[model samples]
Target: MAMSKFWWKSDSSKDKSIHWMCWSRLTAAKCKGGMGFKNLRDFNTALLGNQAWRLISFPDKLLNWDPTLSYIWRSVMEAQALLVQGISCCIGNGQTVDITNSPWLPSIEDPFVHSDNKAISNQKVISLFKIDEKAWDIELVLDVFEERDAELILSIPLTENDKDTWYWRHEKMGHYSVKSGYNVIQASKNQPNTVDNSRFWRKLWNLKIPNKARRIQVNAQCPVCNLCDESAIHSLVTFSFAVECHQFSSVKQVAGDYHIFTEWLQMVFEQSNNRDICIQEDGLEQWCPTSSNSVKVNVDAALFTDPNRYNYAIVVRDHLGHLVQAMSKCSLGKVVSRAIRECRHQRSP
Candidate 1:
């Protein structure tokens, strides 16, 4: 509450200030048209959930904990449910996975089977596979499960040699991350928001201005209008001067009445003509020739996250701009061979 007070009121000291927006709205993702603020409770649960994921994924690395375990471990155990909500198992041999009990489907939202067939109640996932081939038995799957469930089951890729492994459903790399866990918690809360404003927030934040100018000083009465309370929304949207400025712009007129500053700004952006856009190119640097006897060394670097490596190249050129000495290397483990192969492939085209 105190944090929210500070965020909303820049000049707030002793006197009470009006809360124009709720804390939940303020904490919503910037994409969802709110200031992206971390919900501490949800974030804490996500952090604990990471510990829970480690226990579930690599149980050998952590010590076995009973009721005698520390409070922190107990808290992490409590957040196991939160971790469970965002993770699923990638099907492999399918021998150990229970068809109905295990979350081994390709889909993230509904991984568990909803089938109530008592005959296959205790059956394993292996039973759904074809007897002769390693693929799913199409006829048996269609007859046993619903159309949606059958499709999801069939879509799951199975590695005949590998064992079933747990994976984070939200991540493309199938790794449990704190960021993905926090987003999952945020989604579960079901915030009522429509239309993404991430681009709007980005542009607004990117405006070339001092950081202090972004903070609004709340005033009891508008200095210009001297009619109502001075807030960002009121000053920017409801004020006569602002409306007149909008009206005079290429936008022609204020499209509609808007109480929120963000909504008004978004509407203006949507209604504005793209043809009226004026591009201001920054001053470009002119290339200067090297000294008659001196050589210039040009360097370039590329970073790759897949293998966690960096590749750099250095070229020494004489005053004539002809390459004299060229050298390149890959760092952070010996991925130089792979980097060379990729660079050749890219350079070929």
Candidate 2:
């Protein structure tokens, strides 16, 4: 209620204002037309669940706790139920997973085997694997289960030497994240996503405007132009300096008269040429070799415009500067800076 009130109420006003949308809708994802505001309760639960995930994933680090323990530890332990709902066992050796009860399939929805066979209900996932071949026993799988169940079981890849481990089903990399946990909680409510303005949002975010120009300023009146209000559109498009920049830039004739900022941005994007700009600073340090007995890894990535692909290469070298391994791959996707952010977040304590 406090969050909702703060969102709807103005800084200058103490009087209550009408909330334009329900709290649930307001907290929905931006693609769904809401502002992507986090529901504090759900967010708090998700955070606690992340701590619980750490406890489960690293049981060795766990300490004995009771009602007398710290409030934070007790709260995290209580959120184990929330974490359990969104986690599934990734099939490794599959020795510990129950065939009927365990969630071991390569799926998020209905991960458990949907089988009526009373005979295999109590069996473990290892029973489905060929003992000698380190692979799924195809004949036994086909004969013992229904078609869908059989197919799902066959689709699961196994690492014969590795032990079964629980993973977050909401993420592709099988890693638990607070955002994914929150999404799982949201999914349980069966909230309908009415709008999908993802394309518009993506384009708006991908605009090549500078950070200083993108941010909203307190004063609306243009300090330089004096004739119009200063906004993203005005500063980036209509201001005299911006006009001069466009004239000087490779994109020689960008118009500032478009009715909407998106249209103007779209025009700028469409008309813009793929011109590479490089700035080199003096006194930049060069790569140095690692310490003795250690190996160093370096990775570089490039974004290609014509085919919309990201190509990356990784190289590993020993302390002696001898090449250990080198590999490169190309993938079709948006820029991978988001992955970098995820990696940083996951590594945070």
Candidate 3:
């Protein structure tokens, strides 16, 4: 720690005012409102934790005469103790998991330990899995747990392996590394700063569309305002006349001066929107010929310069390139009938 402070002072050339932010704040991650400086203390702890985990998980390796007798090994034990705070076990055949104590369940709360059956105290989770249907033995689970807890246990996927796998919750794919360890430490201390402009922006987004989220659904266009495509993020946050409404509300100065969308939501929302923008119908490669016995329907529409009008067409093709059905339509009035015409003129399906 002293060596790091010495290096910091040398790097800064003894300029006190130019340091601007404190050492701790600068050491945080950018996403968590830090300057991206590496937190050496956390970094050291993370590295030590990895070694400690290895020693604890594997004891028979090198230096056979009691590894804990050494100072380095003892220091590593301290780091390992801290690392276990963020560790959880993924239930497999569940041989290694202690069902009552291990942090295997996905819920925020620990597994309920007040089971009426004392026999299950040390039993492996795999004992509860039914191989026939590749699912948990629901009756046995319900015997030990309430309905809600039983549902959560059943949701976790069980593997055919003979042992459970340990995972660092902060890391990806259940694999631990020094970088992830450092991140875990930093996140433990991270506190949201509401003074920043980003905080106010987060509240503006309308995220109450639970129905669409549950059914894996999204609307083609904004439900309240038909001009822009409706999304769970940006479009939902705004009405069609947001500018007018905000301007009229006497808060235009505060709203217009800031950039669009909230700070935290903007970064995440844009990334999700970009992934779905790929064109699935690229060309003729996607067009496969109909099967010998079954017919295929092909429908397409062309948009017109008028917002209310469209030159729409639909056709069905047979296995032998025969036209089984055909239809065409165009709007004759100012009404936005392109969508309505497409649905109603579908051969009354």
- The segments of candidate 3 whose C-alpha lies over 4 angstroms from its true place after superposition are 1-20, 55-60, 63-68, 107-119, 130-135, 192-349
lDDT of 2 by residue, 247-319 (tens): 6555555655686678887776766655522223594545689999999999989998868889999999999
Tens-digit lDDT string for candidate 1 (60-92): 875646647677677887687787687888777
* Candidate 3 local distance difference test against the native: 0.63
lDDT at 35 for candidate 2?
Answer: 74
Candidate 2 segments exceeding 4 Å error: 65-74, 192-349
Least accurate 10 contiguous residues by lDDT in model 2: 272-281
Q: State the C-alpha lDDT per candidate.
A: 0.77, 0.78, 0.63
True-vs-predicted CA distance for residue 304, candidate 2, Å: 44
Clashes of 1: 0
lDDT of 3 at 187: 61
Instruction: For candidate 3, write residues 294-345 as lDDT tens digits.
Output: 8888777766665657676887888887888999888644544444444345
Q: Assess every candidate by TM-score.
A: 0.55, 0.52, 0.46
Question: Alpha carbon lDDT of residue 180, candidate 2?
Answer: 85
Q: Model 1 — which ten-residue stretch has the worst lDDT? A: 334-343
Evaluation by TM-score, superior candidate among 1 and 2: 1
